[model samples]
Target: MTFEMLFVFGLLAVTIALFISDRLRMDLVALMVVAVLAVSGIISPTQAVSGFGDPVIIMIAALFVVGEALFRTGVAATAGNWLLRVGDGSETRLLLFLLPVVALLSAFMSSTGAVALLIPVVLSMARKSGLQASRLLMPLAFAALIGGMLTLIGTPPNIIVSGQLRAAGFEAFGFFDFTAIGAVILFLGVLYLVFIARFLLPQSAIRETGNPHPTLSVFTERYPTAKQLHKLIIQPGSPLNGQTLSEAAVRSQYELTVFAVQRQGQFLSTLQPVLSQTRMQALDTLILYGRDEDVHNFCQALQLRRLGFPETEMMKLQQRFGLAEILLPPDSPLTNHTLKEGRFRENYNLSVIGVRRQGLALDTRFIDTRLAAGDTLLLAGAWEYIRALESKRELVVLETPAELQEIPVHAGKAHMALSIMLAMLMSMTLGWLPNLSAILLAALAMILTGCVTLSEAYRSLNATSLVLIAGMLPLALAMESSGALSFVVDYLIREYGNLSPILLCAGLFLMTSVLSQFISNTATTVLVAPVALMTAQTLGLNPEPFMMSVAIAASTAFATPIASPVNTLVLAPGNYRFADFAKVGIPLQILALAVTLALVPWLFPF
Candidate 1:
């Protein structure tokens, strides 16, 4: 091997080791790879940061926002509610409806985002159906992986593989090219999970085993001082107009706590001590919690314009307002910050009325209390805004309030959101524009139509995933630049070129599947795809089946918690150990292998 080749191999080893260690953040690890490569001179400084500029990276980032818009507007949850209606309280029945719906959604959007939207819904289902979350999450995750194979834009791997084919001078695969085989695998996957796999899945101690907490009602009952919820808009003439919340002594003097404050059409919260300095201004909306009499007296004494909350408003909280319980994830940025410092309400457009730790409501008066992993928060806001919370890495929505009935977050925007998404998909499938342009237009439409806000569109981007893909891209370049990729391809063809095409395809499937379990699967596809194309050219065989195998194998990230972001998203909330994934995922891997070996050649033979 050349010295450059050796250096790249050593870098890969260290990167894999750090990823497995789980000590440092994955994005930091990716940056470490980018730095070492740039310093080593294997690739130029420009190449080191090239992944950031890659269309694949940008497309992935834009898709995150689009998927978040769907969730925020309640488009995703509408699918979950379909499952609940058909489930009828049976784990088998729920899985029957759940896996397919999740898979279909994954076919269009980011699978990780799909799982994030469904996690809370599934948890609520677990509570209602007396099933463990462990029973549901793995199936949800695996189905999403399979779903990625359903469309050209479903996951990064599909896009990378198509890009690779084009780079190799072949017509890129069609948008639904993957569907024929993907549909069968999806059906088989659902059957396996529903009938067999759910039994094998773990029942972690973290999951509420017996009766689950009454999610939203508990929040309402536990907030000691907030028996009644009221809204008041501060006008310019109000006596407290010039004073900060603390100086105004609204809580002590009025016996009411400001749950949330909205200013200039943007909602703000006083969770941070810094917010105590947020002076009362005219036209600020205050959501106050207290006894009816105390709130009435306070409003009268202060001459604040008390806005009567319509009974209809409270009745349709999901449509007008939303309630949900969120759990902080391990090693999250929000873990150590108090609500005030974190500006939870300001960032999320939600109100924090209660916090639960160790199954008991802590003192809500301590707005500065530091959040911890597994800390439960009861938040209320516009259902659309509450839906946006799922996109936040720091907070995992655990359960939708049963009281809200999972109200659609977008009132008029659902049709618009769905229409924009379909148009984006049609454009890609029909070749009206390049995938990147189509995605940019769709994402921009999501914002222009009020499906999501500017900050939200940006927040929707998963920086870690984007960075990881970008950092790893240079390694793919290095593989070809240093002759490492060609070396491996030559060796494989020399050994297996004469084998039946199916066996060769099977070998490719195993290798790609295993590699994806340890690294970013998109990166795996970027690396393997060129080699697959090269091998096909050398063997004088059709490349489609071989390329399809790589695409499918790249997505078999089921066997490890660290395998895919989707799995990582579920690991914490499911309270899973690494072995839990292995025990279930390994078997599914075998099944997927069998399916690929049986089907790929049949669909696209040499």
Candidate 2:
């Protein structure tokens, strides 16, 4: 290989390694790669930064704000609720409804944005319905991928391919050009998940057998034959006041089993055998399970309640509308404050339900455990109060709603967003506006409409992706400019020279698929488009077919999280391991590849 080729290849290798490792943030890594390329003189400063001005990148950023606006307006949440209601308990029905919805939304918005908006909704639904989250997340990711393939703005890959095609002297793809093939692939993909995936996919939610708590086991051990039951009351002055059964009891109290507790307006646990002499105070509740009613009664005598739920409209409203969770940030004002002194509920309208420390759940007397940094408080109150808490310098609300009021005023600028997008697509497809100008206009509209504010529009844009594209575009240009692409094309034609055009298209499709899994889809398209162009030139074949192959390959990145942001978003919430993706994604990949390889050449003949 020539020194330039070797250097380009090495840069690609480093980029791949950094992406896979994920030790640094992706944008940071992308920036570093740009710097290295510029320093190596592979690309100029203008080229290195030119990607920042790319229309595709701008559209992606604007779309993020639009998606966020939808989320903030409760539109996405409302849709999620409706979908869940329709889904009910049937997996097939859920898939049937979800796949199309995700795909459609992703086509207009972003796959990452679509997945992020859906994940929490899905997780909440899963927990409520007692279904495994793993079962739903993979489908969500796959659906986003399928949806993104449907439109030019659906994913970055589509835009990249369109830009490359424009550079190669062919008409760029229209907004809906890929829809037919994409729809077919999407339908087949959803069908595979609905009818076939259940049997092939493993039950990934296996919990650890047996309790991990030694102290809790003490009661069971002592009452080996005693059928133990124990009880405790929230005494008016005792440390057990205002705590739930699940959060109380750190170390074991003899052989007593605290089976259940009752609090204001709620039963903490269901189904407990009634015990005699079960007296509860206005502020006190019971936590008892023991064979000997006498022993249970004895244990209740030692507790006291320190406070009572105040009788006030504000308190009642606070109870009704607010949900609170303590975020243990390294620098929180409440870190050292006790519940009473902190005035957590009185001042902030937040009621602490439980504390999570190092994964252990605690609900003891408010003052029993000192609040520490990194302890997650589970609070319950109004959503507004939770939002207000987030504004506090010290507290973070993890589950605050994306409210419409928070949406930038320009969010209603969907009309402008769509118009600009259509104009860009048409310009490229008709060979009127250059790819760069088309994208720049679309981005300008986004800013003008306030769909994305000037600051947000600029901030949300991925400099790394822009830099990667710009720096790599020149290398791709150099390869073409220096006749390297032609040389490679000649070699390929000589080796597979006798193979039909159909097979060549298939090869390109498969190669793009594999490269996409390990690199940015934009990078893959930029790298491969030149070679496809050269091949078309040498064979006197229609370049459209070859370019289409690259487009399909660039987008069919379902096998790994590193391949797509949508997949990564769902990983933690779905509680999915890496293997879960391979299980479902592999089949989808094969299906998409098979369809693309067979269909591309037919649609645009060589």
Candidate 3:
């Protein structure tokens, strides 16, 4: 080997060692690779840093925002709800629904995004169905990996391989070109996860170091007033119509708290926070919390009709409003004063629905009761107002309901977000715009339409993953520039070229899949794709099947947590150990190899 080749190999060994040690973060290790390569003069410094500006890197970053907008607008959660309905609390049935849905989503969006969005959903499904999260999370991750094979934009590796084909003076693989084989793999994968792999997954309970987040049931049980929620609509001739909440004096006159108002929209109803200046309109649905007697009297006195607050309505309330516990500090200015006397509603824009003293519920009219130090108050209001309380010095936020984390922030814009995504997909499919352009446009649309805020879009970008990808791209360039990639390709051909074409394809898949278990699959494909193409040309066989095998193998990152972001995402939540992945992943990898060898040649002539 040339001196430069040896140097590159040494650097790679150290990088892989650091990755395995988990001493430094993956992105930092990647940066180290870039620095070493730039300093070694294998590639120009400008080339070493050029990967940061690659279209693939930018597209991946943009994909994060697009996926996050889908999450924020409740588009992804709606799919989760569909799973809930289809699964109906059966573990076997849930897996059947969860795997395919996640895979199909992964085909269009980022696999990491699909898995991240559904992690909480699967956790919820587990909680509701009395199933272990481990049984579902591993399959979810695997399905996401397989889903990447469904579309060219599904994962970075697909794009990398397609770009490689284009760079070699060939027409790039079209959208849905991968669907035929990917669909077969996903089908066989779902069946394996449901039957064979299901038994292999560990059943460990979710790990918790401290107190877990309180659920809605826990709060409703502790604070009975929460169960007294009711919905009332004002009649046309009602006294409340056209009157501001301040003028209505809802708390004092009717002994009821208007948490929010359900206003009718052009096509749907929207929940608006009940601010002091919010005017009451005829037919406005008032969401109230109070005694049953008060709700009945208020409806009768105001000529309003009462509506049932069913479980679905309560779920909507949970999504639109925030319920949390706050403790009054000893130095709080409002201490020793009743809520009404302290003007709590006027100052904080939240309603104190229940009070607990010394761990006992005070079974009195909480509005008239004086606050005390160390007393916990159950506050109900819009999420924005509740979040505002975080900066208040007088009160300490004790806990928030778990539903708060799962609530969709931009549910009203779901249609807009979905439309943007569809347009982007159609543009890519019809060749109206480049894949990167479509992704960037969709991401920008997400922010412009308020599906996700600018800050949220920035926050949604996974810096570790992005940096890792950017940093590694330079190393691939260094390997190719330094003749290391050529050396490896030549060595493989000398030993494996004489083997049958089918066997040669199988070997390539094995090598790529094994490497993917330790490094980012995108990087794996970057290094292996050139070798596959070169080997195919050298052997006078078609390069298409070889490239397809490489792409499929890169996504077989199921055997280790570090193999793919999707796998690591489920590690802690599933309470899984290292062995948990291999128990199921290794077999899946072998099965994928078998499928690739059997199908790639049939689809793409060798």
Best by lDDT: 3
**Model 1: clashing residue pairs?**
271-340, 272-340
Ranking by lDDT: 3, 1, 2
Give the poorly placed runs of model 1, Cα more than 4 Å off.
Answer: 89-91, 105-138, 148-180, 199-202, 205-214, 219-412, 498-501, 516-548, 560-583, 600-606
Tens-digit lDDT track for model 3 on 1-606?
Answer: 999999988887787778657677767887888888778899999998887898867886787788788878877666666676788778889899889889997897668756766775677667645688888999999999999999988888888989999999877888888898889899999999999996798866777678778876788889888888888888899988999866877787777878888775521136877887789989888888889888888888878898876654565566678788999999998899988789888899898888899999887376777889999999889887887888998889999876676667898899999899888878865678987898899899999999999999998877766777778778767777888766875677678878877888888898888777765677778888988888888888888998999999999999877677687667666877656788899999988888888888888988
TM-score, cand. 1? 0.61
Better of 1 and 2 by lDDT: 1
TM-score top scorer: 3
Clashing residue pairs in all predictions, respectively, total 2, 26, 0
Comparing 1 and 3 on lDDT, the stronger one: 3
Q: What TM-score would you give candidate 2 relative to the actual structure?
A: 0.53
lDDT of 1: 0.74
Which ranges of candidate 3 are over 4 A from the true structure?
Answer: 71-95, 106-141, 151-178, 194-215, 232-258, 263-269, 273-286, 290-307, 330-333, 391-396, 402-415, 448-450, 515-551, 560-584, 600-606
TM for every model, in the order presented, reads 0.61, 0.53, 0.79
The true-versus-predicted C-alpha distance at residue 482 of model 2, in Å, is: 8.3
Order candidates by TM-score, high to low: 3, 1, 2
Question: How high is the lDDT of residue 474 in model 1?
Answer: 75
User: Mind giving the per-residue lDDT tens digits that candidate 1 earns over 358-396?
Assistant: 888776465768888888887766655766877887678
